[model samples]
Target: MGPRVARCAILASAALFLYSCTFFEASVVPPGFAIVYGVSDYYPASPPISGDSYDLTYPDDDAIDMAALLVEQGFDVILRTNEDATMTQLELDFAEIGSRIEANGGSDTRFVFYFAGHGYGDGMDSVYGSSFPDAWDSYFDSESGASEPTGSGAFTEQLLLHDAMPINSISVQSVDDVLAVLDESLSDDELSDLLGTLPSSMQMVVIDACHSGGFRGSGTAADTIPESYEGWDEGVSVLDTLDAITLYLDYGSGLLDVGASDVGERQAIVISASGEQEFLYEGPVYGNGIFTHYLLQTPAEADRNFDGLVTANEAYAYARDQIVRVENEFFFGEGKFVPRVSGGAVDFVLFEAR
Candidate 1:
């Protein structure tokens, strides 16, 4: 046969072989890292009018367990729980994750980020908090037909850090400016004390129960919160969230240092405890957050292909099903903890659980 005819025959034969073969696709777990955060306690509740009464009971345990799980899977884990989780610290941790992945080399670098705690999603942004609850205003606004006062800086979603941070008062500045607020030694409460130490003329901006003030930028020092921070997959980049309730605050002010976040796209995979619009469940049943419990405990039967390796898709389905079943048995039927998974293809190897 002519060369062209022979080539066509070979192509057809190869296609047939591949179609007939039942190969178990093998995707190994890449050298990766993870950042896990969960808040079991929110010390400062929002105003009584806000109606954020319930404090999470399992996030601290969730963080600890998730970090351990990642470590078992051979991932470098950085864990933060309860009071240690502040907006500033969270942002820095994210940057550190990016740095670690880059240090290990980019491109094929893998990452798994897990958060088990309080999360709120307005029509636009999903707001996550350390231990704080969303305010009543979070539920409604003029755009949603509420008669409440209108304002700029409306958001689609944001992850809240620290405790009792006003959605509007969140900082949205550059990482440099955010870090400039103070050395990493300053805790959220210390941030408040930092303000107190400032000249009386300088205002203060509280980030959480630990910190309760804002800076107007009167002093030469960089302002914290409500500045500019970019990076990340979407929505508000850094802090720079609108501090809408400023009328009641004594913060001076800070700016988000200009520039993009240095943290690369380290969030290769994110396993949030709940969907953007839902709240995660925690109970004594599994002795941990609902999603987290299932994540670590789903039967090995989850290996649908029985290839000895569990893909992320398989693990997610298994965990989600188990979470629903357990939540229904123990909690109210109406309240569902819909776990969410985003970023990267679902076919990646999540765990080798052989």
Candidate 2:
């Protein structure tokens, strides 16, 4: 071949190789660390009564169990549970987790935060609280006669930002509260300012509840429901803003500059059990939140790539497919479960190295 032709061919080959390495088949292996927090029963209150009312205590248990599972796999874990553990306690735990991860070498560390409990949301933003029978109206200050409204409880993500955890994945199994916090936390420029301090890689959030309060019988069963409940309508908009954030981070200027890379390509992945208009079921046999049940059960089988490591994308795809299949087999429903994800490729290994 002529010199000019040979040069062109070599350049083309290099371009193809780079593209394959960056996009087609890229794998990341890193040390894993995690913090799991679960709130089964609220403090200063009796344990939640099962059978009569929905079992509101499972999420916390699931979270603890997941943390333990991670620990068994070789992850450094921080686990906490119960009523005495308020939102503040949870925040403190996350701060510690973040600090430790940073000290251990932030970029090299793969951090995960898992939470399970009652979550409340005001359509736009939601929060996970320490108790069941969450009084949305009372907390959001929607009821005129209610005592001073306390905003939704602390979001674990916000706490991580506060503590400066760099590059992590956060999986939460609260209802609407999960979405609410994501909506609000990612929107607030101040919150972004705090997050900007962390090293950029990827952040994943998994919410297991319907965004719309309109699920046929969801809030109707409780007579003492708070006024803030009004804001939760069925079919409310999905938390699409997260998607926008991912796109912006991928192409837009960095968090510091409009034209330069500011936050690195840090991604935020959100997996919700249902759309804003749907309902996520929690049957007695399911033993835990419907989404959580599916998540715990399905991904184990979907590690199709057999990389011995599961990325955020792989896990969500597995959960999404299995949730729909199981829901169809059991409920024969149109769309009882859905898992949505945003952000770039993330490294989320469900199992630790033995």
Candidate 3:
């Protein structure tokens, strides 16, 4: 079946309040173009991080396999791995693809961007009680009207490249510090510029790394949280609690707000392997990032309705369920690896089996 459009209206509310009520249009089986990147190597090529066990074992594999899966689904795919997966190359590719799509008059192209590598951010979610003690004091205390800060630090998430390196030399730094250095290689403004090249309004961005959800942005669904909620813990200050909840939902919601994009009728979905304040893990048993391992299973198991098509949401759901279940079983229910998706109101088919 050729691509078809679908309309969706959703009114979603949290236990405390309605975060969003949106009406959006979705598409199915649209003509697809994708760029997939995976980095299993890092800076200091002499000894090689991969050789030192600091490099990932399966991200390169993830990129190759994901590209294969997209090709099978009939998407025009570009795969970048290891040395080729650099910010400069990505910029060139983005510009080239954007030109091609623009040449077509910005048709309803389904654009997909996937990255499997080191990502920046603290992945500190207070809503779920996860926190970075150092950053917590400096980051949130300022808003909470606390006295002179004990810690002076902040955190945000960003995609990393192959040549990423440390920004500072802290004998013992937090996990967030490591992710941050890699992220500093690519600024958010630069990323936005790169994305601006793509003329398509319909897009799907998938990130598999620590704090991947931060890419979803925080202005949309996150602004829906109410200013007043009586459920605050007695021991916590209101500002502290609200800040935690807001940041968590902002980075973890997996929703992107493209309302301001110049492209008319814009709708973009972002799927992340972990929450903004979370880290992803891979093991030899799976031979891929846990999130990717399950996502690769989409073609075979994600068609929940068995309609011969697997929509983006369907694929996300299937992967998410499998991740949670498997992690719970293996970690005895202590697993916190949860994938997230953020987008406008529409969900589109990403794969078709006929």
| Candidate 2 minimal-lDDT segment of 10 residues | 214-223
On residues 1-354, what C-alpha lDDT tens digit does candidate 2 reach at each position?
Answer: 699999999999999999877774545556666666555554322232442332354766677667767676666788776553454565466567667767766866565545555433332233323332333323334533222111111111221111111111122233354333334222212222333443424444455544312111110011122222322224423433443443355343444222211111243334445543344555677677766776665436657677666666676677767765665456533334365443334445554222
Residue 47 miss distance in model 3 (angstroms): 7.8
How does each model score on lDDT?
Answer: 0.46, 0.45, 0.63
TM-score of 3: 0.67
Q: In TM-score terms, which candidate is top?
A: 3
Superposition error at 75 for model 3 (Å): 1.2
RMSD of each predicted structure: 15.0, 11.8, 11.3
Model 2, residue 168: what's the lDDT? 10
Q: TM-score, each model?
A: 0.56, 0.57, 0.67
Clash number for candidate 1: 52
Candidate 2: stretches off by over 4 Å: 1-15, 18-28, 43-57, 123-200, 209-267, 297-299, 332-335, 345-354
